[model samples]
Target chain A: MNVLPRRQFIGQCCAAVGATGMMSALSALRATAAAASIPSGNNLPGTEADVASDYRALVCIFLNGGNDASNLIVPYDASGYAAYASARTALALPQSTLLPILPKTSDGRSFALHPSTGELKNLFEGGKLAILANVGTLVEPTTVAQYKAQSVKLPPQLFSHNDQQAQWQSSIPDQPFKTGWGGRMADLVNSLNTNSAVSMSMTLNGVNSFQVGNLISQLSVQPASASSPKGGPVAFARTTGGNNPNRYQTQKDLFTSPQSNLFSSAFGTLSSNAIGNSDALAAALAATGTIATSFPDTSLGNQLKSIAYLISAAGTLKLKRQVFFARIGGWDTHADQVEADVSLGAHAGLLQQVSQAMNAFYNATIELGCANQVTTFTASDFGRTFTSNGDGSDHGWGGHHLVLGGAVKGGDIYGRMPSPVVNGPDDTGLGRWIPTTSVDEYGATLARWFGVSDTNLPVAFPNIGRFAKPNLGFLG
Target chain B: MKPATIYLAVAAGFLLLLLVLRPDAGVATDPRSPRIAAPPAPPASAAPALAASPVASEERSPLADGLNAPAGTVDEDLRIVATLIEVFRSNFPRDGNPTGSNAEITAALTGRNRLRLALVPPDHPALNARGELCDRWGTPFFFHSESRVQTEIRSAGPDRKHWTEDDVVTKQ
Candidate 1:
């Protein structure tokens, strides 16, 4: 062997230990023999080298509680408004308050967004956003007649909160919860992130099904708060530099020490990995510094701001493809959804929060020169009733959603817009519109844009083939 | 004018002053006391205007007398329960607390906490052994929360089983 100096030998040993620690921290995400069996399929029209060189991210903003979609994307034409106003008597917003939009191609009807969603309207007019109408969880495509006749399978527990939320996140409504579509997508494309130490999936909201995967688990990060304004990895208390430097060493030793019991051994390994991961992430984020773009100080704004920071550090973290999850609650508007003015209340406040935060996030992406690379989409448990129940609406089936980015074919409404009439052709009963487009179709489109191939689309969304259009063409 | 007529007018004025001064002169002194007759129901047009007003009304429904005196239809009983729950929710607007389950709601309404809002008396017949608000059919009413404030009250109707055609439902 070649002779080496004492200093060189010590440096090499330290490097070896550090590399081992990083590998152990990300042990779950390593592409082992078992993980190699997962179907990645062939990437879309691109070589592996091309895909590895590029970057893209999918951000999911899950609005907790069933949103009232009837008032969200309203009909603004005279006759359409007449029907909407007739159905939603006291809860209807004034026609003058509605912010009208001219779709690229309309289905013989004009539309306006909720008065509170002015930013969304701006995005629509600027050709950065597109609306997908009447999308919801479905076993397969079913019409009002089939729904009434009970001739087709339906999503289990249609109106309940927890069940519907799981169904929407999983995108596999027919089967019991196995994994979220986001998680599955991450698993398939995780190879793109060649040298990443952290999981490709990160969540601002703690512990969601959307980011739970088989190989790569979600990493929960805190939003910018008063204590830690520039939020990063949630570190353990006093685990770093302190007066008791020996204490940190002792704790690390205890965690990494071998154990006889299986449970203790597992716990020790997890704790050691957590410490290593947190330190690695904190260092990466500190190196990336901060972006100059200003974000709002609200709950959702803080989450999106944190996400923007994380995206800025994607290169430092060695991530090529990433998925993020954020959530905001208080959308369950059973009563007090609107006030006497019909333009302000709980629902309006929530919508404004969503609009402002989303707008800020999109701007931040543009500032980072990744506007065309990142796509943000909105989802909720389900839609609310079209017919108002005195002051608010009840749980319903289908609802509208917003998809926006620089690459979107925006300023247009896709899918079939249901008739506003209660008990109409689209309505099964009580204005619960049967979904014309399934969640599988919507997710498949996003997966395709995120670089998932046609063959691997089924791996992410098993029910995608049941739907006619896998690519909705909203994304360019 | 005669001096006697003037004295009589002064005496009537003094009596009216006494009537106005005495707080208990017009209405029943005790809130728990039975009223001779129920107040007329407010019109449909007035409902929205009075939506945020106080829950205490001059009208006495079967709910005030306890479920033992329930002589109304299932639909009427459900409405009464829903109105009571609505009043409870209005007082405590905090989301997800004391609204998750029937027992929690019962605890809040029956003065088990610091607020001490005796919306439903502890010994009322509407409450079962478990302290849940029961329907006229002697079954606990299912409280489904659409949100923190809005709840759907369902009573297992005549058959005393839930999710059936005869079940009575009301959203508040």
Candidate 2:
């Protein structure tokens, strides 16, 4: 036989193997195509070498039920407080009880946080937290005039809960929902991970629309429990325990066996991959050591703690990029949202839980040496009305959210803060302020920081070009 | 002829002329006129005669005149009924589900339901003895709703019948 060059021989063997494993080979080829598509002099912040070696994560803490953000972040100045107090009426917090925070940049007005969010106040002062103001779902840049005249397109079902939730997650309000921004971002950067045992996208809570992607599937993992501090992968019932080796083997055979039916074959293949991936992730978590940071014991606290643990196991799993989702509910406070003591009530209690849990999670990241590598952000269905409907506020658009991580340019507020006046210039009516910032701009900022190039930003947020700011600059 | 005799003849001729042309002037029986009859006056017994307190009068004044008099164009009558329903909704925001039947909404407005504050006085002329809200024509108003929050109110107009072309409607 004619002797071929060693490199040529190896290349021929790979091409021959690629023909047999077309699906797996196609993923590798797509990754190569994605890298090749990046034009020279790209807007990505780091060099290609840094992009290949570094790891980053995004944690989305969805505050289920529309959060009454008017109470969460309040005005502290004399005139500003007067306006807020006049609009909110009975729902307003006492001026003296607020936890004061002075942002690095000011719009000639002062502000403060709720009394319950003392931990968050510390994070803000320490330059680890930034506030994003007046952000919400928008079909396009809309003005109060445009809204009243019905000249500009608006997101469908403005105040209803489920529609707004999906709009916030998908970030493509103009189109029918197919994938979430987080899901699309993961699909774009999935090539960064050379040896990920589990999917790059993970949710501590159950499956969510935020992590639904076409190429990559989100792995739903349990929160950290007292028994298992680092939460383990969701396993098959048979694999959990019992001296039934025959049952486990039989289940395995059912998944591995060939099926002539198309549906059955697809099911078998999906089930087999799930089982195999779960086993691999479990093994990886078991081998990795735990971190020393302490976490709170609440539900949200447990979820964040589990995320911190997963971040710790990133090395063992060989993941370069990760995205996480967690959620907390009971924010729909239409009635009895506050007691006679405005500073203390259902809303304040929820804020306290969020502040404490986030503080603990941030400390955990610091201990794991990935404080700058991990960014956690908050989202909600919409903001509550500035004007109270008797005891509580109603659903409104454009709320404030919090962003926290070492990489954040913290101790500052980003986005235009709406004037807290009912039927003011920004108000569409009844204190529902038209959003100054779109969700597309907000998600694109985080996506850019997470290694997505400027050219591919629209793949994640299709409407980012419609908004003035693609990157909100909250992240460094 | 003499002057007195001539004057008397002219007056007689003018009188005859007036009599002959009066039938052609179309005063009461003009076919081209719209001919909207005035709403029937409510019965005297239907009006409430109570010592009015300041609070009760303030709450009752807006609907009191419209309910007691009940004489207006169809659009005006529809406006009164729509305003009544709007006031009811504002006071009891939790009670979003207003029934489509005229008697049911009339009962709720008259303080017969929970939170009995009597948004509309029971003795108001707009309500019949059966406690159903009535149009200017003394016919019960028809209510239709597709959503709990929005209700359409229809007045029977001068014909005093439902589902006719002469009905006036408004939504609240």
The numbered model that scores best in TM-score is: 1
Cα displacement (angstroms), candidate 1, residue A283, comes to 1.4
Model 1 chain A poorest ten-residue lDDT run: A10-19
TM-score of each: 0.70, 0.67
Chain B TM-score (model 1 vs. true structure): 0.59
Candidate 1 stretches with Cα past 4 Å from truth are A1-53, A239-246, B1-172
Check candidate 2 and list the clashing pairs: none
Q: Candidate 2's error at A162, in angstroms?
A: 0.7
- Which CAPRI category fits model 1? incorrect
As for model 1, its CA RMSD to the true structure in angstroms is: 17.9
lDDT of 2 at B128: 92
Fraction of real interface contacts that model 2 preserves: 0.00
lDDT of 2 by residue, A129-182 (tens): 999999999988988877754556677556656667888999986666677888
Residues A154-272 of candidate 1 have per-residue lDDT tens digits of 77556667777888999987777767888889888988886656777887876677765666666767787766555676554443344355776687688789999998887666565
- Residue B82 lDDT, candidate 2, scale 0-100: 65
